[model samples]
Target: MAPCVTEWVTSCTNLILSATALHSSYRLFKDHRAPSVGLFLLGLSAALCIVHPSGSYLTSIQKEAEWAGEVLAPALVSFDFLWLSEDHNTAHILLCGSCLLLGLCDWLSADALTVMTRCLGLSSLSCCLTVCLFAGNALGALSGVALSLPLLVAPKVGAITFAPLISPAAAEGLVKWLLKGSMAVGCWASTRALSMFLLDVTDRCNMGI
Candidate 1:
């Protein structure tokens, strides 16, 4: 029961982290100058899955004879034993799976937006507005990640301790701050660009120059 509870907590935490990473990636991609940052974050998020324990250790447990005697031994036994481990492997799986899905959504959303703009022959103002709106959403989502950055990086500190001279928590905090700043800058720039585009359109119509 204690193990199950731990798994639930870990799973929930991973879900939050994965969601934030995905949101950050989406917003970063919307910024023409920041797509590289978004891609970096997306890659980082995927790398988290690699660090996640695969739960293979759960299989090391000795099974009861009756459990092993089942007709569909592999399926039934494995399913029943999934949540019994201390490492919360089930939670890791859920976290990785959610990240995968969110990454897909991010990609699809960007692709769809690009296709729509091209197909509709959107004007510069329209394109600017679309990007601004998307960047705003990304900024909102990134705030969640920034708020939860500590929790997200806590589990990795031990592994990072083996390295020389760097404190994992401090490093993570710096990275989080940098990412937040970058996103904020992108949002501000997009808003400014949109305003300029609107002003240009208005000038073109009014001056006939």
Candidate 2:
């Protein structure tokens, strides 16, 4: 069936464009600046898939199957299986570690870093810190899904699963805080309004207007 261009307008592509605009807005706000809980979770999801349980990084898929029976399914509620194995838990550690690394690195700068610069966060030594890390991250995430398709659909020869992140663990702590700073800042922003609403409704009934 030939589809509707109008409906497609509200799809993932649209949402991403909107997010880019918001991200840009946040950057402006910082100067402006950026991500929070929601963005952190989203970033984590992309990272895990790239570093798939099979691990194209530390090792190839075949070498890690026994251990990766561990990573396939995302921990919907917690990080239990993620860091569960203690010693050999490469997949979980790398996935979560990436977020923490990014958060801690970005805090040093006053301005928001781009995806190319994301890797710089991993290393203070990166000369093209902005391009190597931040821009790399942005590219990785935008491309992460398409990269995971083969693993996601292929028959499971191993115990692991390449999946999207769904739990709080994915966000780490600092990353979530960065992404959701606006939410926190907004909370502070709404406090005066909240106070007036509360006082108007309960304790101060004597006002005439």
lDDT, candidate 1, 1-209, per-residue tens? 25465445444443444454445345434432222243234334433432345565532221111111111111111111222222245424433433343344345575553343232222222322333354353432332233222222322344555346655655544454444344334333333343343454457669985
Among all candidates shown, the one with the greatest lDDT: 1
Clashing pairs in 1: none
**Lowest-sum lDDT 10-residue window in model 2:** 73-82
TM-score winner among the candidates?
Answer: 1
- The digit string of per-residue lDDT tens for model 2 on 24-50 reads 333323211111222233323322323
Q: Give candidate 2 regions above 4 Å deviation.
A: 1-12, 15-40, 43-88, 110-209
- Candidate 1 RMSD to the real structure: 19.9
Residue 24 CA error for candidate 2 (Å)? 27
By TM-score, how accurate is candidate 2?
Answer: 0.19
